[model samples]
Target: MPVSKPLRKALQHTADECIDCGKCMTYCRFLAESGSPLSIALTALSADENVDALSHRTYDCSACGLCSAVCPVNAEPDNIFTELRYHAQANGIFKLDQYAPLLNYERLGQRFPFKGESLPEGCTTVFFPGCTLPAMFPDATRIAFKILKRNNPKTGLVLNCCSKPSKMLGLKSKYEESLSALVHTLERKGIKKILTACPNCHVTFKQFNTRLEIVSIYEELKKSSFLPVTPSVKEVTVHDPCVTRSEDSIHKAVRELLKAMGVRVLEMKHNKSNTLCCGEGGGTNMHNNAYARNWSRKRINEAQRTGVPMATYCAGCVNFLGSDYPTAHILDLLLVKRKSIPKPVAFPFNYLNRLIFRFTAL
Candidate 1:
């Protein structure tokens, strides 16, 4: 697990680019409270001093990309932190045991991928509902696929993990190999377009496999005539997942979907570009549950301050944030007809949903 020369150089370059203006620190909750801003940590890395301190700071980062988003010089501290994780791993400073559960989850996904057989002959577009959605909301997953097929008869369904867990965990080589293989498989099957349900999957596909067209299902739904059997809820605070902070189009589509369902969308204190992580980004929650939960609680508290329930498009977000406050997936608000607010999918059931989707939907 030697760190690549290019990555080392890139880390050094990122460190060199830091001007110590403290903009990233001003925005990053982890850094602001911890007193070890990325700029300071990167400087220490370049100086080859306080290596242990640097490793701790890097591991503690949520990798939400907010630091990078606010960096005036585009220093990309978030990317730097990822590279630092790899660096620590190569140096035997970071252990894998803490992340065993997440790694095992990813291993299962890679081993038991669910490539559905519901596509028409010569279909070039596949609806990829990523692992979380199919695992948490199988019915919504099915409905989304049917809507896609209705809009275009050639639309198909492909259920699989996007290997984002590996990527976020700094298993760079493994992630690249698996993702590339998946992309090649889809290309061989003439999958020119991928309709993604998970924001992480959407970002991962667009980042790793640029050869194919990657579009969010939310965006696709906007172009279709499908309307949700609106729920009884009137207003909700939309928690835009951190992965799609830069994806204005996806954000717009999610809000529009809510408006179409006659629900008034309330903005969180941090929404859109400034949205906080749901504690799952960069696989931080796998290693640091308390830290992750604190972030989720902060978000839930903010939503509660608005006197409305929390709503998010990401199934992962709903699962994590729902524990702290009343949270529902936008699909639940749009699609489910429950007389009461929908509950988040619990653990064993979520895992069961993944298995059921593979056997039944495929």
Candidate 2:
């Protein structure tokens, strides 16, 4: 199959630019194994690379945007890798049976299997609790939503997936279809803005659904008064989700909320736009569990240095990082006052929790 325009452009750009400085590989194992984007692009364009191997390497990328983050020439190798994954999938060159579980989970999200919405009259904005949060911690989701509604009566609830799984899996058609439905639903409901509880959803809406304004729920929380809590914890390290790497304002909101609770914030070595992945990025774990945990362990190693609990804004991040250390979501911290992380919810329970929230919260 002929290379798609986007993929070809990304390839040509990297080939023309990247000077093999190796800066992007400093923190990425995938880049270390696969070589610089310039090398990959040159070999690929010359037909000197094996297609399957290259495709596998591309899919192994965390899609964490770290490569482009450090690139002095800004070649955006992740973009090239992303487009190549799409091309491979579209052309039937990509297939991994291990992805069956992930595909099914994404299908459930796209199907509105357990969706709920509360769009009352005069409600122009929605509080999207997102998939993982509501699934794993329905109570926390309820608390977060109640806070949202309390802070702004005009606020509403939207329990829908952002179809990010499809997008990350390189299912271009499915991603567009599911995302279009979300866009249409927001437009039909007259939702002018979204307050996302999950950073991934925030990124999704901001990237794909420009028709509606996107705001972080943390930002919203920062704007309101919270139930006053005597501080049992004095310090924490904030794990800024890699998905929200560019959203410095959201990061500030999280820290401000922590400060309000009288907790001192510890900065990680890699933070803000340069924050490390929680290892769940790019659906790479579906391909290589060890590789995914490698990223997670790196973050754990960083958090361990501070000798403090790690607080993150995303429930998904908490779930991924909790096993190695004491990690809790910002909402879990503010609403529930949790000191220890809960066990990661399994499949049926996670789905059941979402279903229960459908009846109870929405």
Candidate 3:
């Protein structure tokens, strides 16, 4: 596989900037275990003989950006690995079979993409509950919509995929097409503000569609007078989704909401900006399931050390962490009055939930 000149230059630039401080490796389980940080791996890739070994290392990364986040020199290994994925895909060095299930899921989303229920006249804000939220917690989705509608009669609902899965899969052109269509739809409908439930969707809208104002549902709920009855559980550890690590406001807002519901928030050792990935990040589970599970195990262990149940806002995070820990979504605390933690939906049910949302909610 021949690397393009641009990619080679990018990799070389990252290699040159790396100081081998080992800060990134401390945050990266894959790099720590493999003993190959960007400093060493990218440098090795500069030689053609090391491409195969380096490529395998690149795929091993979850691209969760933990390394980049802790990099003192601003050498973004995650970005470099992303470019490497593109390079591998272009040169036909990477196999797509492992990614077929995720690809097919994205394809289904594209095929039956959700449309927003129209807003009343002069309304500009709509609730863009991302795909997973509706699928995993249908009742929560409905409750969120009802609250939004109650707060503002013109509040609308938009159910659609944000195409993060496609982006993570290194299908740049496909992701752009999906994103462009979404932006066009919002613009066409005169939507100026989006209240997003999923952190992935919130970040995607902020990155790709800057023309619109993106606010988390947590933030919106904070301002509104809507408060559901509190659940039986009082104290739980929070697992912030890795994608929105930089967004302190979302993190604060989630905690505030939990506090309002009279739930005592137990802080994990890794919280806010320093949070770990939920193992499902960057589509790593598709290609490197073992590596992904290692991350999840580490996070679950940390939560267990706190001696409290784990709670997260992202449906994806809840699903991933719930397999190992007594994980619950914040919505469960707010919307449900149950005494026990909700069970994570099983394999086929997870897929079926998405389909159910596509047909019924959309």
Candidate 4:
């Protein structure tokens, strides 16, 4: 159900173009440590290989687009990973049990119904909060709603799955079905502009089509001063999302926002354009939680060196990190909370990095 001529063509093109320069493997925290080109290439060629824990490997991708960024032939390992994900899903091998919290996501979308609370009144902008944020981090969604109301005033949220989780885990039919539902919801609402908090969903939407103005919340924040800056957060480290920052300038806005909040920010050695994956993207956690945990731990330790709280704009990153250290989402940090939980973002980027490197390097 997932394969098509265009999809096949794109996949093979990327596969054929690979120079096997090993440059991608160099920075590939995945291949650099546990992976091999032969295995990765096989996984890409066809999803038939046992791949033994291939699901875990797929989920661990972080979908950071880094491989594509470093490729000499522009083979785009990220794209290969994306296609393989769909194949994995089609084979019923890549289900996200870790995202159980978001199981209510689809129900919530249908129950809440983006019918009444949507924008343009017959125009095109829709507020799409991916499954993770609304279900796991309600506060961010609350803040998102508050800001959307304050800024656009007329715009309303379009509740739906965005198909990111489904797509990432390789569920082709489900992904398309979810995407169709989204398109129908928007069309029914007469909405055009799509504003999303999750970067992965934003990218999925763009991949399907670019007819609408897909804007990120961080991007919207840059245009207007809706939320007040927090002077208390004098020092903090920012974590970038692998799937989100491929070619976007939003991470810069995040740094700017942090500066505005009075947070003296320190950059990660792999920050911005070369940002590291939280190890949870690319559906890796669903494939291999332990490996995902190790990758996340590595990142957490990196932030710990700054001797400051770790901050990220992504809810998934926030949830993954919040399990261990004093990790907080930028939205939660920015929002003045009456009662707060000072938990840190937990998951490590890699076990090796966590064990081998110390914070002094940061």
Candidate 5:
């Protein structure tokens, strides 16, 4: 692929900034002897040098930002990958398949139940349930909605995709178009505050310059006292998504939420600020499934070491570990024994309305 002058300059800039301090190796499992040279070469190469090879390694990146954190010089390997993904897609070095689940965002505006329906006039906060939350894990989705309705019935929700997957997949044009639609939808509905459940979506939409206040649904639960205590004893390990824990407070919030639910929170040694990538975030799941599965398996094994089920805030993390661990969303844990267990979809276990009372009341 022929790289333009501007792209070449950017790649050179990335290579020049890297200090080769080996800090990135700690976060990458694939940074062994043979791959070391490839990493170095990719770092050193101009944007035009071996576009396929660059894009191949780029797709391998989960874009977790761990490398940036560990770097003594503060060099950002993930941002370099992001820049490359943009340049590569624009220059024809990358292409995403049509049916890839990430592309579902483009179809969301038309399919959402709230499309033509009007939200209540007086509602100030609207829950924007991202697509994966509802489709992949229906039971958890119901619990999230149930929690909001039980405490704050006035809260309306705009159900649809956030188009982050599309952006990660290098479909920049499509991502922007979908985002514009979503923005208009919120504007038309008079939604001023958005409560997002999906970590990826929450972070993605937060990047846009908009007036609507975006807050995590978990944050709202923490403040509104909307979450109910359930009697359930389960040792749970949480897999923090790279996108969600940028500031590390989300990790603490998740732990607090779990502890409040009577679930013993077990830490993965590499958790909190140092959590491993979920392998789905930065286009890896779409471009390379086997790699994503391998990473997910590694995480599942770590969770299994604790001898308990796992919980995560991100739907992608749960979907990534489907059927591998006795995993459920944090909302699912909260819903246990309160409402009837929602029918198990092809996703995480609901386990709601089945709370083990022995574990209740702190």
Candidate 6:
């Protein structure tokens, strides 16, 4: 498929502005193999080279924005690669089988059988426990909503997918359609705010919606009531999710909550805005397993730096990081307070748990 005007403009900006400082390549492997943003842009936009040849290179990016974060000249190469991905998805170049999981997840967005929304009397706000969390930690999902409901009588529960998988997969037109439908749905439900646990959901909704206020559950939980946690691991490393990289408030809120619980936060080298991806960014794990594994390994190694268990906010991180290292979602610490890290649920059980949680919560 030919490069669209927007894609071309982004590429041209990188090609013209990138000075090849290689700061972006300091941590990311994708940039290492693909060369500087300028070189990639020149190769991609060159009249002689077929854009089709770079399909693999484009999909390999985790789209974690580390490149843009480190670039001295602010030539966001990640944004350029994102545009390239939309081009690949548009031109029918991506392998359908490779993206089956993301495609299936997107298909269930609003129509999800377990999306049982419960709005309180005169409610204008909701606790949106997004897809991954509900699947992997249904009890924590319910406990999160219960805390919000107790704090704000107007706050209610809504089990929904933010369709971030669609956005990451570069389903441009379809992604817009999904976002519009979600906005309209919230409007119909009189929802004015979303208190979300999923970092990707917070990022995705904030990107497209203006009327509805998007907030992190971590921030909300700061004020909301939850059981006092006697933390299983007192001193722990924190892995901030990529979507909340720049949301200083969210990062602080997480730390404040831990501090209130008397849990010591041993900082990782990559924390806060500089946090690495948990291997699940941009649907990269679906299309490029090796790249995804590399990212997960990086995060795991960072946790070992402090030589303590890891606590993160994103449930996807808990799931992907698996048992390779001791990692638990913050909600698990606050709500469940297990003696050890919880293992990720298998595929069919994950769905079953969601369904059960939805039915039982209703």
Global lDDT scores for all candidate models: 0.78, 0.83, 0.79, 0.64, 0.64, 0.82
Which stretch of 10 consecutive residues in model 4 shows the poorest summed lDDT? Answer: 353-362
The segments of candidate 6 whose C-alpha lies over 4 angstroms from its true place after superposition are none
Off-target runs (Cα >4 Å) in candidate 5 are 1-13, 30-47, 51-53, 105-118, 149-153, 227-231, 338-344, 347-362
Clash pairs, candidate 6, are none
User: Per-prediction RMSD in angstroms?
Assistant: 2.3, 1.8, 2.4, 8.5, 6.1, 1.6
The better-scoring model by lDDT among 4 and 6 is 6
In Å, residue 23's CA in model 2 sits off its true spot by 1.2
Give the alpha carbon lDDT tens digit for every residue of 1-362 in model 6. 56789888988999998999888887888888878888988888886245666755677889889888778897878778888778777887775577787778657646758666888789899888888888888888888877787788788788777777767777778888877877788888889998889988888889885589999989988886666568788888889988788889999999999888988999999889889999988778876789999999999888887899889998888888866888888988888867777788888998898888888876
User: Which of 3 and 5 is the better model by TM-score?
Assistant: 3
Residue 68 in model 6: lDDT: 85
The better-scoring model by TM-score among 2 and 4 is 2
Q: What's each prediction's TM-score?
A: 0.92, 0.95, 0.91, 0.78, 0.82, 0.95
Q: Scored by Cα lDDT, where does model 5 land? A: 0.64
For candidate 1, report its TM-score. Answer: 0.92
Rank order (by TM-score, best first): 6, 2, 1, 3, 5, 4
Q: Positional deviation of 90 in candidate 2, in angstroms?
A: 0.8
